[model samples]
Target: MAMAAEEIEALITGGIPDARVEITDLAGDGDHYAARVVAESFRGMPRIKQHQAVYAALGGRMGGVLHALQLTTAVPE
Candidate 1:
């Protein structure tokens, strides 16, 4: 089943309490998505690690229920 944007946001925010997450449906198909997550907890982490954190937040949904996530993560300045 395809994932909804609200579900994606809920997963991310659930994992990262302090995260500010924005999820977009790239194809409007509920399968393709883009997420921009900014969190204070991400400070001092590398870009790859930041992305990893977000992926981790998804709890292994990347290729399953949630597919094709173009993720961008950043720390609060």
Candidate 2:
């Protein structure tokens, strides 16, 4: 099943646990998604590391179930 916005938000929140997450469905198909995640957890990490953290949260579903995640990560102010 394609993931809903809330489901994606939940997964990101589950990973960072302290983030302010925003998920937008770029396509109505529920496959193209854009996410902006802000969290203290990302404070010192490099951009690649931050993205890696989020991807890890999806486990092995990166290609099978989830596709086209346009991710943006930020450190909380």
Alpha-carbon runs more than 4 Å astray in model 2:
none
Model 1, span 1-77: residue lDDT tens: 99999999999999999999998899989999999999999998999988888889899999999879998898888
Top lDDT: which candidate number?
1
Residue 11 shift from truth in candidate 2, angstroms: 1.0
Give candidate 1's total backbone clashes: 0
* lDDT by residue (tens digit), candidate 2, 5-73: 898888878877998999989988999899998989888899999999999876766777887799999
Q: What residue runs in model 1 are displaced by over 4 Å at the alpha carbon? A: none
Give Cα-based local distance difference scores for all models: 0.92, 0.87
Candidates in order, TM-scores: namely: 0.95, 0.92
Cα-based lDDT at residue 65, candidate 1: 92
> Candidate 1, TM-score vs. the true structure?
0.95
**Residue-pair clashes, model 2:** 0
